[model samples]
Target chain A: MTEQLRESLSALMDDEATELELHRVLGELESDAALRQTWVRYQLARSAMGGQPVSHARLDISRSVSAAIAAEAGAETSRSSLRERWVRPLASLAVAASVTAVVVLGGQQLYQAGSLEGQSAPVAASGVSAVGFVNSLGAVPMRASYGAQAVPQLEPAARTAYRELARQRMYQYMQEHAEHAALNSPQGLIPFARVPQIEE
Target chain B: MKCVARQLASSVVCGLLFWAGGVAAQGPVCSEADAEALQWLARTVKSRSEVAYQGVVTLQRGDDMQVVQVARSLADGYSSEHLTRLTGQGAQVVRPHHPLNCTHPGEQLLTLGDRVEAGDCGLARYYRFEVGPGERIAGRQSVKLEIQPRDMYRYGFLLELDQDTALMLRASTLGRGGKILERFQFADLSYDEPLEPRSGMDTVHPAAHPHPDDPTAGARLSVPWIVSWLPNGFTATDAADPEGPRRTYTDGLAVFSVFLEQLPRELRPGEGLARLGSSLSYTRGMHLADQPVLVTVIGEVPVNTARMVADSIRVAR
Candidate 1:
C-alpha cells in the first residue's frame, strides 16, 4: 500500500497523474506522515533544480480539507443529488452541441480545401472530345462554369508535359477498350462508334 | 329519385366490368408482344453476321454527329464488313470476318447455328423487354423495342427495327431518368443496292493516333494485378499489354476496362473523372509492385461504379 502511494505521489510530482491517481495521492498524504515528508523532499529537490528558494516548514492543508469533507458528507451528498438531476441532461446537451460543431467545421475545412486546390492549380482541359461533347449538351452547367472560372495558375512546364503524357495514356486505353468492346459486344460496331476521335 | 340513382349505380358497375375485361385481355397480349419483340431482336443479331446489305448510318452523341456508310458481304460462309465515315475527315474501318468462335461469346450467343441456351444469356432476368409503338425510320416501317435494365449497372436501350427485314434501324442509349445519351440511326438504307468493293480507296485518314501506344498490337497477357471488388455478374473478359497491363470486365451487357501503367518519377499522379457521351472514365494513382502506377477505369457505367472499380484494384500476391 505504501509502495503504491509512493508511485501515485511520484506521478503527481511529475504532473502526469490521472484524476484517480491524484485523488489517491492526496488521500494518502492526509493519512501517512512519512509519505508526506517524502513528497515535501521531492518538491524541494524539484525547486532546487529550477534555482527556486524552498521553505523548510510545510502546511498540511489536505488534512483540514479531508476533515471538512468528512464533516459535510451527508449535507454535500444531499446537495449533489439535487445538482445531478440537471447536470446529467446539460452534459449530454453539451456533448451533442460539440459534435455538431465539429462536423460543421470539418465540412467547412473540406470545402475550403477543394476551392483552394481549384484556385491554386487548374487541371489542364484533358479529353478535348469529352469536354466538347459535354459543353455542346449544356446539361451540366457546373462543368461549363468550372471551365470559365478556372484561371490557370503559373504551373511548371514539366507538369504540363506530365499531363500530356497522362492524356495520351488515357486515349490509348480508351481506344483499346473500344476495340475489345467491338469484339465482345452483341451491339456490333456500336461500341467502336463510342471511341472519341482524338484531335491532334 | 331513388329509382334513378339505382339505374346510375348499375351503369357504373357495367363500365368497371368492361374495363376489367379490357385489362385482362391486355395482359397476355403484352407478354406475347414482348416475346415477339425478343424474337425480332434475335433475328436482327443473327442476320447482322449473315446478311449482305449497304446503308448509311448517323451516329449522334450530344452535339457531335457522324455519318458512316456501312457495307457487308456474305459469301460462302464468310462475311466482310467495311465502314467509311462520310462526314468529317474520311476515316474507314474494315473488319474482315473470320470463322465464328468462342472468342466473342456475345456474338456466339446470337449466332443461329449455336444459339445460347435459354438460361445462358439471362436476358429476361437482367432486362425487361417491351414492344413500343411503331414508327417510320429511313423511309421504312419500323417497330420500337424498349430494353430496360433492371439495375443501375447497365444503361437501358431503345431499338427501332425494320419491321420487314428485322434489322435494327435506330438505337439509343438511355441514361438515368430516361435521358437519351446517344443515338445511332439509319439515314438511308438499301438491301437491293449492289455494294461496290473499294479495295484501293485511300481516302481514309484514320482516327488520330496521338499516342505511341498501339492498343491493337497489345500482347494478350495477364498482369499481376487483382481486383478485390467488382459489381455483380461482372467477369474478367481479357487482359492485354498496351504499353502497360490492361484488364477488361463485362457483365454480359455493360463493360469496363482497367489499365495500369507505370508513371515517371517526376510526375505525380492525380485522380480525375472524364465522361464521354454515356460512358465515364475514372483514374487514380496507385502503388503496385513497389512502383507508382496510373490506374484508369473506363466503361459505359455509372461514375460511382467506375470509381469503385478503380479504387478496388490491388497487386495480386
Candidate 2:
C-alpha cells in the first residue's frame, strides 16, 4: 500500500477524514489484514470514549442480510432466466459487499435523484445537468445518464418494469466487459482486430 | 523419587520441542505450486492488459445464451474494440478506452494496477486460491483455479486459465452449491504483442458536448430517505443530491437512484417489481421512519438485492 493510503488509514483512526475518504480506504483495504487491523484500531479509538467494542459480528450480519435482500429483489427483475436459479446466492454475495458502504451511496443518491433540496438549487441555477458517467475499460468512452426526465416514479407497474430492466442491463454490461477482457487475453492465436462474430 | 521426576521433565521437554517445530512450520509461506500459479496469473493479467487480441466468447445467463466475436487492440493506456454477434444483432461494437468511463474530460481514471496488487502472496489478502480438477474448454485443456472468498461479503470466482499462456479462457461465478450462476467462455483468443500506448487514444474522442444545458435539468427532488446499511467494498463514486431533480448513488459495480417527488397523499403505492430490458426496479411506499416514506431501488443486480436495498431505505428524521 502507498504511504498516502496508510496516512488515510491513520486519519480515519483519528476521525480526521470525511465519510468519502473512509469509504475509499475501506473499499481497497477491506481485504488487506494490515489495513483491516488498522481500521479496527481506529474504530476502537473512536468509540473508546463511549466504551463500545467494534462490532464485527454485527457488521457481518448486516452484510448477509443486505445481500439476501438484494438477491431476492434481483429475482423479480429479470425475465427469460427462470432456469438460472444458481445465480441468486452469488448476486447476494456481490450486493453484501456494499453493506458498510453507505455514506457515499447515501450522498450520491441524494445528489443523483435531486433529493438534496437546497443543494440542487445552486447547481440547477447554474444550469448544470446532473448527468452520470460509469467508467469502464477505455474504448466505450462515456455513456451519459439517461437524462433528468428519465427518473420516473416508482409506480407499481413502473417499478416492475424497472426491476426487469436493471437485471438485464447489468448482465449485459458485465458480459460485455468479460468479453473484452477475454478477447485481449494473452493466449491462443486470433488477433485483437479480428475477433470472430458472437451470436445471441 | 528424583529419578522419576527427571524422566517426567524430559518427556515435557520433548513435547515442547515438537510443538515449537509445528508452529514454525505453520507460519505463512507460499508453496511451490501456489507460487507457480500466482506467478503465471500475474504475468498473464499484466500481459493481457498491454496487448492486441481477439476471441469468440459465449456468455450464458441462466439458460439464455449469446456468442460474441470480439477484437481488441491495446496501446498507450487505451483500447480499441469491436464486438459482433454471430447469432443476434448484426454487430454491436465498442471501442473502449482505459479507465472505461469518463464523465468529465481530463479526469484521471484509476487503473486495475491501482486497485489490485501483484505478487504470489499479495492476492492472499483478498482471496484464497485452490487448484481444482482440470477441464477442457474451447477445444483446449485448462486447469480450474478457484478463487474462494476469504470472507462472506463477496462472491467466489472459478477461473479456467489456458495452460499455455496462463490467459483466463473461461470464468464462472460460483455460489453456495458450487453452482455456476453465470459464465463467460472464450471460443478462441490470442494476444500478438505487448500492449502499446496509442491503442487507447484511437477509439476515444471527447464527447462533442461535455456539459449540456436543458430546461428540465433542474427538476425538484424530495427527500428524508435513508439506507439502513451498505456492503463493505462499496463507496459512492459520485453524487447528484443537488436541487435539480432526483438523487443517484453508485458504487463502481452498482448504481441506485432515489427520486423523492412528493406524490399526492392519496397515492398509496404498494411494493411492486418489474423489469425493462436489462434493468430491474422495485418500488415501496411508507411513511418515512417519521414522515411518509416511499422507497424504490432500481439497478442491474438480482431482485433480492434490490428489495433488500429498498427495505433498508428509512427516512432520516
The TM-score leader among the candidates is 1
Structural similarity to truth (TM-score) of each candidate: 0.56, 0.43
lDDT of 2 by residue, B191-266 (tens): 6542222332223221111121111245454554455544332322222334432333332222344444343332
TM-score of candidate 1 versus the correct structure, residues matched by position: 0.56
Q: What CAPRI-style quality would you assign to candidate 2? A: incorrect
Query: Mind giving the per-residue lDDT tens digits that candidate 1 earns over A1-200?
Result: 36457555554444434447655776776778777555543332222112211122235435543444354444434557668676755543443343223322322233223332232222333333431222321232343556733222212322333334434545667766765566555555566566555222
Report per-candidate DockQ: 0.06, 0.05
What is the Å distance of residue A130 in model 1 from its true position? 22
Reference contact recovery of candidate 2 = 0.06
Candidate 1 displacement at residue B3 in angstroms? 81
Q: Write the per-residue lDDT of candidate 2 for residues A54-74, one digit (tens) a residue.
A: 213223322343454455567
Q: What part of the reference interface contacts, as a 0 to 1 fraction, does candidate 1 reproduce?
A: 0.12
Chain A only TM-scores, each candidate in turn: 0.29, 0.26
Point out where model 2 deviates above 4 Å: A1-200, B1-45, B96-127, B132-134, B139-143, B150-154, B163-166, B192-228, B237-305, B314-317
